[model samples]
Target: MARSPKDVSAHFSDVAEVYHDLRTTDQEPIISIKNQLGHLLYKPSINAADIGCGNGRYSLLLPQHLGDRLRLTFADKNRCMLNMLTKRLDHTCSSEVIQSSAECIPVCEKSFDFATAFNAVHHFKLKDFLAEMARILKDGGLLFIYTRTQEQNRCNIWGKYFPDFCKKETRLWKERDFCRVVAQTSQFALQDSVYFTYRRVSSLERLIEQAEGHHYSTFWLYSDKSFREALDRFQQNITAQFTDPAKIQWTDENTLFVLKKIREAR
Candidate 1:
């Protein structure tokens, strides 16, 4: 069975450093997410919150996109992750860090102009988290959610090589389901939904190292025996299919949902 969100958060605290190292790589998909956010509206003295802001990767870019005009609050359930983020920012004046869960954000109601969650929603209690987001967002405020839907995950290169990848990621919401949840709230209107594709090419050796490191949360759920067996199969498959271990390629597919708060809560 999969662990509860609280348990998962605790586990992440233990592996925060490894998680940061694996995810902070100069990947094209990550770059694209940042670029897309840059295209959105940014104004002077705007307040923003990044929920579940692991290691502050996406939040760190907001300053560059919105300049000193942006005041940011980074929130996460994991204290260790928050501590790492604070150290990374070196306690910048423009930002504050809070240890809070997504279901109950520790901020005043209608306090933020913008909010974001990158690949973190699957771990949340969806209904409660969305309600909290609705409560915290100012009228006309925007919310950006970037994640890989179950459909997209099934199409990933890892799914092809590791047979259990898709099965283990059953918690991920489909694109249609995500859209419906936002629309059903009647508090947000869908502004835009975009699908992005990026190609990642890396040495097979490096890929195996990432797998062994349990870079993804899904990998953490696998038992030791299952993880080792999967890795062995993945390596064998790569060796048999590719002529060179240095030229392995994979497709990364993601969806970015842009939503606008349309009206004040009744």
Candidate 2:
């Protein structure tokens, strides 16, 4: 059965702590986004929001690149996830944590200078979320989406061991499909699309631990019997394929889309 949007949010709420513990902000993508934003002039106050900002991983990193003037809003539907972010960020003046879904952001339209959704778009009704983003962003405001396409997910190491992982995550958009969706929005123009690749080296034991902890939402969709069977197969594959678990490397690929809101005519 396909999980509804509410079910997806609930799953994240259930594993909020574990997800935060296992996830880290990828610095490479951060640098890529920072470079793209370099051409824009910095303002005394920059209004930014991170939709589905899980545990404030990316939010915490924004101040460095966006400067101290960044007033960030971290929005997520799961209260547990928002609570985690609040605790980690300590409710500073520079940041506000809001419990809201991406489909209907609670902010005023054209109020933000920048917006981002990091690996969170798949959880949303993409069309509504994109339109909401366009409405909320100031004219020329940038929206950055950092997510894995279905193709990228299929190429990951998890897909090799757990075939169902890719199959079950059919909600992920392909790159071309994503481009088409942006075109359909008509409120935003695609500025740039880039793929960032990184090598993730981990022990088979640790990888198994992450899977058991449901580090990725896809793992939450697995039935107990299926998860156990897949884990066993994954273990066997690792044992047969690699002599040393420490030497095992997985390729992590992420696609970033930089879109800018079109200015309204007076």
Candidate 3:
């Protein structure tokens, strides 16, 4: 079951603490994420925004060579994540923060140079969010959306044995189709869709911790119990399914869609 807005808010509020520690850059997933986003992240124009900037992973990893070139905004509905992100920055770049939802960003039309949303697109109301992204960016601006592919898995054996979990997770990204709709309706051009594969070896404990940090442990199947107990069951199910293999091989693959705003016909 999808969490109620209140519950999701509360979980992320608690999740903000130790968020960076739980999903450290040392993790394999981080390597994959950085490689996908490497080029698009230059210094922003005078204005930019990071929507759904949960725990600010993308905010923290903004490229080094760009140097204090563009004003930046970090926006999220969860105060906890925003607070954590605020403390993480080094204070060199020009930036501001906002508490807002992606579906209805609290910004004026054509107000930003560019916008970036990483790994959090699935959480928004798509039609409204797409319109909001289009509304906030200047003519000829850009938006970068990146996310891991559904095929990536923590335990191949278990993913093969019990595919329902994978189905549930994969379904969340069906919004990718809405990207096309957004492009057409919002007067943006589909510049390019790029695929990148990244690999790193991580300990099982670290892998579980990263998953828990995102609250992936609270799938619909286990939501009736406390999140802790649900987590145990989630771990147990995967462990039992992959019992023959003492240590499982995990892979994370991602796709990025680059969209550019074009001047709408006058």
Candidate 3, lDDT over the whole model? 0.63
- Per-residue lDDT tens digits of candidate 2, residues 214-265? 7888876667677788888888888787889877787888999999999988
Candidate number with the higher lDDT (2 or 3):
2
C-alpha lDDT of all candidate models, in order: 0.78, 0.82, 0.63
| TM-score of each prediction | 0.90, 0.93, 0.76
Query: Which candidate comes out best when scored by lDDT?
Result: 2
Ranking by TM-score: 2, 1, 3
- Per-residue lDDT tens digits of candidate 3, residues 97-198? 889998887778998876778777767776777778888998877777776545544334224433355654543464356555765574677776666555
What shift in Å separates residue 238 of candidate 2 from its native position after superposition? 1.7
After superposing candidate 3, which stretches have Cα over 4 Å from the reference? 1-7, 24-45, 149-164, 183-186, 211-221, 224-248
Error of 3 at 109 (Å): 2.2
RMSD to true structure for each model, in Å = 3.2, 2.6, 4.7
Model 2, C-alpha of 210: deviation from truth (Å): 0.2
Indicate whether candidate 1 or candidate 3 has the larger TM-score.
Answer: 1
Most TM-score-accurate candidate: 2
